[model samples]
Structures are given as C-alpha cells and as structure tokens.
Target chain A: MDRPTNQKAWFLVLPVLLLVAFSAVIPLMTVVNYSVQDTFGNNEFFWAGTAWFEEILHSQRFHEALARNLIFSAIILAIQIPLGIVVALSMPRKGIGVSICLVLMALPLLIPWNVVGTIWQVFGRVDIGLLGHTLEAIGIDYNYVRDPLDAWFTIILMDVWHWTSLVALLCYAGLVSIPEAYYQAARIDGASRWAVFRYIQLPKMNRVLLIAVLLRFMDSFMIYTEPFVVTGGGPGNSTTFLSIDLVKMAVGQFDLGPAAAMSIVYFLVVLLFSWIFYTVMTNFERGGQ
Target chain B: MNFAWMAWTAPTAIFFATIFLILVGMGVWEYARPGGAPRVGILRFETTRGDRLFVSLLGSAFICLAWLGLVGPNLWWALGLSLVYAVLVFRWV
Candidate 1:
C-alpha cells in the first residue's frame, strides 16, 4: 500500500528528532568530545586526537571483553532462535489459550532489566536460592559467585528465560497472520508436517523471524545490567562483557577518554551488525517478492 | 508470599501499580471500543492501536531502564524520554 506523499509529515517527525537529539545525539557528542580530548580536573582538556581510540584498540582488556561479548551473543542466538521457533510452533493457535500464552510469555519482557538481574542473583545464591539449594541437594556444586562456569551458565539461562518469549511472540504473530486457506491447501495435498512448515510456515514467518533475530542479537550484544547484577563481572573477569568493561572504565575509574572511545567502537559494532542483518533480510525479502 | 507487599517501598509499589493501571485501562478501552484496526502511520504500513501501545510501552520501559542504568536515579529523564517516545509511537509506529 503506497502512502500519499506528504511533506507535512516532517512536522510529526520533528518532535522525535528533537528528542533523539537531546537524548541520544547530545550524549553521543559528549562521548565523542571526551574521546578526542584529555582532561585533568578543573575543566581543562587537551587535544589528543585518536589516541584514546588507539589505546582502546590495543588494550588486552578490551579485546577479551569484545571476544566475550561476541561469544555470548553467538551462543544466545544459537540457542534462542531455534528454541523460540519450536516454542512458537507448539503454542496453541486458537482459543483463550493463545491470549494466556501470550500474556504469560510477555510477563518476563515487561520486568525491569535490573529487577531481572536481582531476581536471578538472589535465585542463584548457593545458600538460600532455590536453584542453588536444589543443585546442592542433588550433589552438584553450583555457586555462580565462586565458579566462572556456573556464572556463565546462570547468566545464559537467565537471558534465555527472559528473552525467548520475545522471539516466540514475534513468531506467534507471524504464524497467526498466515491465512487459513494455505493450511487447507496443504492438507488437501497431503503434505507432511515438516514439509508444510518448511514450505509454508517457514516462508511465511521469514519476515518476523528476521526481525526477531535482529532484535535479539542487538539486545544481547549490548546487554549489561542483568549480567552486571548477577555476577558483577566477577569469578575472575569471566563475565566481563564489553558493556560491563566500558562501564568499569567510564564510571568506576573515570577514564573518560578510553571509555568514550570504547563506547563509540561498541556503538559502531552494533550498528554494523544491525546494518548487515537489515541488508541481508531485506535482500531475502525482496528476492521472495 | 503473605507479606509480599511489605517487601516493596512506596515508590516501587506506586510505579508498578501505575503500570498495571495503564494496562488495565487499555484493556477496558479495547473492550469498550472494540476497534484497533490498522491505520497508516509514518511507517509505510498500517499498524493497529495495540501495536502503537506496545511500541510506546516497550520503548518507554527501555528508556526508563537505560536512564536508571546509565544515568543516576533521576526519573525526570525517564519521563522526558517517555513523552518523546510516546509521541513517536503515536506518530510513526
């Protein structure tokens, strides 16, 4: 459906632009300003072009954090995408069950990020937490605070529980939007379930699935609060993802220059991935058309 | 669970209650009017009232969360960001 060309739409967009400018653009510019200049108390700054960026690029800490971030995002995508699709497939497609499932699934997504972290943090404590006590009772020594592997496991599980519903919800919407006539045709042709899913449901869900992947990837890549609260990037820096490391630099140590540069790099990486995903998905969407 | 409400401070309780109220208000509105059919926005496609509400609420939540995470505990920033987000959702999304 082609919308009428209307220049007046700029009026509608102006407010958002102003909002983004104040909220995102200004703060980003401050980071950029800090990235290029060195400051030593009393509001004094010296020009140090690209030095901070160079330092960040060469830092072992930055490399480790970046690697951890990439690995975490990859693992999250690997698990969540297929799992979400399967969950969506199993969900009831009709009646009150649909609404109930949707609402229940949406519950986690509605919780504040820090609250999610806190919940998991308490829940994973070895002494009092249910998960910790249960694991201990079963004779598995599970201590997220003390063990690197345990921390990773807890963080990943928490993320999967929190976010899989988003992917499932998007897929469910896609699945429901599929016309009934398509299923009728498939039944008449005696298509197998896998055959039907592959040709009909999968193809139909492509757009929404792409959206789910992009959203999940970007979010997991930038995740901070939950993991920070859960492990505080502890157990020997094992959970120190890029965002946490950046925060430690920017906030903890007040190393503005490197932190600003790191923030820019992080932003660029997310932007690059999102762009790549968008391009690839749109290409596929166009090809299908 | 008996004293679950006791665990919450006044502000947290109020914040959560407000969110609940907004959701309940939306439910009532939807039931009363019964029309959330898609309409063209700034996006090149049609979106329903439910879509707009979801976008607004989710975006606002993120804004609020990010504000708390990145900035200090000031809610003024969150409120300002939410207003902008709501306008954008109603206008474009």
Candidate 2:
C-alpha cells in the first residue's frame, strides 16, 4: 500500500503571498520607521526613541478613540452574530428560494467600502433621501451632521448592513455542510427543534461563527472609510474611532510621529486579539471533535 | 501652490493608482496560472433571461431596506438603496 504524498501547492499560494507582502508589509515598515523617529522638512530624521509612543499612550485623545473603537467592535459583534444566525436559519435550504437568498446576502459584500460610504452619505440627506424624509415625517429628530448620537447610530447601522451578510453567509455554509444524516438522526430520536439546534446545529456552527466574529471584529476595529465618509469624524469628534483619529493625525494634521506610534499600537492590539481568538477557537475545535 | 487641492486630489489619485496596480498585477498572475475559471455560479455577471435579473434587483432592494432599518432610518437609507440598485443592474440586468 503506497502512502499518499502531499501536493506542492506553493505555486498556488506564492502570488497571494507576494501580493500581501507588497500591499501590507512594505507600507507597514514605512509606518514603523515614521513611528520611532522625529522628522523635519526635507525628510530629515532624528532619533526620538519612544517619545512619540509615550505621548500617544498618555494623551486623552488617544484614550477616547480607543474607548470608542472598543465599544463599537463590542456592539457590532453583539448585534451581528445573533442577527446573522437568525437570518441564516430562516433562509430557504434548497431550490429557487435558496439561490435568491444567497445572491441577496452576497450583494452587500461586493460593493467597495468608499462607495458604501458615498451611498449612505447621499441617502441620509434631509430633503431628497427617502429615509430622512420618512423619519422627519414621522417626527423623529435625526440629523447625523449635527447630533453625535445620530452620527454614531448611522455609522453602526451602516456597518451592520454592509457586513452582516458576511456572517450570515459563513453560517449558511456551516449549516449546509451538516450532512442530512445528522438531521435524519435527530428526527429518528424524536428530538425537539431546540434539542436539534442545541446538540447539532450549534456545535457545527461554532467553527464558522468563530471565523465570522474574528473577521467582523478586525474589520470593525480598522473601520475608517465608511464612517469617515458618513460623518467625517465630525459633530465634534464624536464618531472618531481609532482609525479615523489615526487618519486625521497622520494624513489630516500630518503629525507623522504620533500617527505612526498610534498605527503600531493599533496593529499590535489587533494582532494580540487575533492570536487570542485563534488559540481559543482551536482549543474549542479540538474539544468538540 | 494650492495645498487644499493637493491634499484632496493627490491622495485620491495615489490611492486609485495604487489599487489599479495591485488589481492588474493580481489579474495578470491569475491569468498566467489559469486555475479553472472561477466557479461560474459566483462570477457570472451576465444572463440573457430577466427572471434572475428581477430576483437580483428585488433581493438587493430588500437588502438596502434592511441596511437602512439596521442603521435607524435616515439619509444613509438612500445611499444603501441606490448602491444595491446599481449593483443589481450592473451584475444582472
């Protein structure tokens, strides 16, 4: 009996590796350089040690942004995970309805980030926008431009709309992958719907749900473009998440040192959380299996 | 020396150019390797009959409304709706 050999898949993966290195790694290195040094005009640099990092760490502004980011990510996870699961559960499992649901769920994921922002920007207007007009007619005082709470609400909603499908789709894939045999077994046992979900569906979904949570958290934490477009971090910095504030400092104010330091901190925080999530998920998988 | 114009346009131009280059590079690499054309079910952007088109449009419309409702009905509702509408037309119709 001959043993099956591992196929060389490096050719398949090399392009992706090169693309990521070029897009993510090189720019990250540039940011690192900017973080640790003081730069004068003409790109001249002087050693500043950890002064920039210290400044950012102690600043009230940084703390506020960090707090906002944490809260946003938490709220998003809380809302999206449950909502996504429910939507996936309700979707038709086969036939024409299945195709319709799948296509609808996937549409939001295809649109570009900035374009999503732009669409929301115009859609939320007081006069011509359907939503604003409807809300106004119903006597809700909602103005994202002037009210911080409204701005925050709008941003959160935008994110949910754009991303919940991703979670739903992943959950659907997990659900569909459960063999019909499992359902048949549950039926033979005369299991209640709750029991079937509790013992079978929930366990199967655990893996994909973990992936969904991590992806959503990371993306939400790094959220910049949509919220930036919608509110411009405006109505007095009320909607300024870490990413928005970072962009403002780095690009808007051109405070390269502080921005770079913030970026490093931001990257590290994401990396740490991701590692923790990965560890917990792998442990859960091993236990379940 | 219009700093404001430079501030906006320069960043926008650079961003677009960078994305274009990345996409082109990826596309070329994919073409050279020629993995069995990406699953047609996922990549199909065109169809002759209008049934799929109608379904796509109606589905997108519902999605847009869902997005609007999720956020708390406001101006963004229009944006979300318009985007879904455009995507339906482009991808299906």
Candidate 3:
C-alpha cells in the first residue's frame, strides 16, 4: 500500500490545480475584495474596512436566515437519513430487481435542481396539481402559496423526494459491501435480524452514513434554487433560508459590500460545520477501531 | 404525456447541450485512454479518470446551481466556479 514518492505525480495534478485556481480562487478573491471595499456605480470602490462585516454580523435579518437554515437542515437530516436507511434495508439485495430498484431510486438525483423546483411548483398548485386538488377534495386546506406551514411542508417534501435517494444509494452501497462471511457468522450465532443489523450491518455502513449525513447537511444548508423557484422565499419571508436571503441581498437589492461579507461568513460557517462533522466522526471511528 | 412544452429556450438548450456533449466527449476520451492508473489524492481512496470526471461534473453542476441561485442568473461566475471545481476534482477527488 506504500506509494512511491514520485514528484512527477505533480504533472498529473497540474491540470486540476489550474482548473480549480481559475474557478474557485479567482471568484473567492473577488468576494474578498468586495467584502473589504465599498463600491458605487461605474465600478468605483472605496475602502470600507470591516463595516459591512460588522453590520452583517449584527443584523437581525442574517440571524433569522441562519436560524431558518439550521432548522431546515436539521429537519432534512432527521427525515432523510432514517427514511433512506429504511428504504435501503428493504431494497432487494439480489436479483434483477436490484438494478431496477436502484435505477428508479437514482432518478430523482439526476434531475436538474431548477427542474425539480418547477415540477414541485406545478405539482403543488391547488387547481391543476394532483396533490393539492386531492387534499382539497378530502376537505383539507392546502395552499402553499398562502400558508407558511403549507409552504414549508411542500418544500420539505420536495427536498425529501429529490434527495432521499442519495442517502439510500450511499447506504445501499455500504450494505452491499458487507462481506458474506459476517452474515454467515451471525447466522451461525443464531442472531436475530435486528441483532445482525445492529452489530454487523450498521457498523459496516458507518463510514458511508457519515458521508451521507455530511453531504445532506451541507447541501440542505446551502439550498436555494428549489425553494426559491417554488416559493420565491415568500409567504412573507417565511421560507427565506440563508442562501435565499443572501441571494436577495447580493442580487435583488444589489447590496454588494454586506452581501460579500455575508458570503464570507456563510462560507466560513459551512467550512466550520463540515470540519467539525469530519473531525468528530473520524475521531469516533478511530476510537472504535 | 405531451412533451413539446419541455423545449428550452436557445441559450439554455445550448448550454445543456454543451454539457451533454462534454460528458459524451469524456466517455470517448475514456475509451481512447482506458484505465488511468488509480492514484491517491486528498481523499484516502485512489481514483481513476472516470471517477474524477464524475466528481468534476457533479461539482460543476453544483457550482452552477449555487451561482445561479445566489449570485444571479449571470453565468460567468458559475463557469469560473465550475472550472475551479473541475480542477479540484481532478487534483484531489
């Protein structure tokens, strides 16, 4: 498993390094520039120091958006992870059904984000949409456009439909990778299904589950397009998660300085959470080992 | 079952077409240059060119989505971010 220390490997890395630099580093630098400087029309900018950053940090708007984002992510993780695990467990482990099931499960993940939003938007309309019409027929008031709870329900459902497959797929891969010998040992021990899963399967799937959780958390935290397209962050800013609020600031209102500062803070928060998740998970893994 | 309304405007169609073409081109490239001996990057696992391609493409799509959602409909920033994502995927993923 020891790799030879070959400097020539840098040649292999050069292409990717250049590509990342061109894309990520440059724009990030621009954000940094905007964060510290004040800009007027005609591209004129003046030094603003940390005024924008301080303002954004102290702003109630930012706090509300951040709170919404945290709550949404928490809800998504709670629902998706357990639901995905259950789905993965129930999926056919052997036979042609396996491939068919996997492909069907993966369909949602491949749809473009905007397209998903559009689909949900149309699907949730009270008049034309099936669910909305059915709910109304059943004597349940269901209007995502007007009701904040309904809007949240629709958005959460849309996310669950779009992303649960990812968690399921990851867990399925982990499940499939479990060695047959482990199952055989469990059988020899006359272990119950729950016992087998708890001790053998769950432990085996830990790494992939961590990946699924981390991905879901970060993605749900940064989510914007699907909800935006569906709700426009409306019903009175009720659904305005941090990304949506950030977009409104940077794009809608053209508040560059504060937006840039907020962007930096947002990026840092995401990085911090991801780092914490990774560190804690990896530490737990090492401790178990 | 009518599908005609799904037709995209010229710019959107062209952009998506180009992405599809690039993915096809990558497939062709892979066929031409077979197994890219797996190498370790930032992650502990060794990845081949195909894995790198998957990561880059997915990452690029995310970059574009985030850009459109957060920075406005203007795509120049998204393209820049995607290019960086592709490089990072190749370099590290």
lDDT of 1: 0.83
lDDT of each: 0.83, 0.76, 0.83
- What lDDT tens digits, residue by residue, belong to model 1 across residues A46-146? 66665676677668898899999999999999999999999999999889998899899999999999999999999998889999989999999999999
TM-score for chain A, prediction 1: 0.95
Steric collisions counted per model:
0, 8, 2
Q: Candidate 3: which stretches are off by over 4 Å?
A: A1-5, B1-93
Q: Chain B, candidate 1: TM? A: 0.74
Off by over 4 Å in 2: A1-19, B1-93
**Which lDDT tens digits does candidate 2 get at residues A104-199?**
999999999999998887777778777667778899998889999888888888899999999999999999999999999999999999998888
Sliding window of 10 residues with minimal summed lDDT for model 2 chain A: A1-10
Binned by DockQ into CAPRI classes (incorrect, acceptable, medium, high), candidate 1 is: incorrect
TM-score for model 1?
0.73
True contacts kept of each: 0.00, 0.00, 0.00
* Candidate that beats the other on TM-score, 1 or 2, i.e. the better one: 1
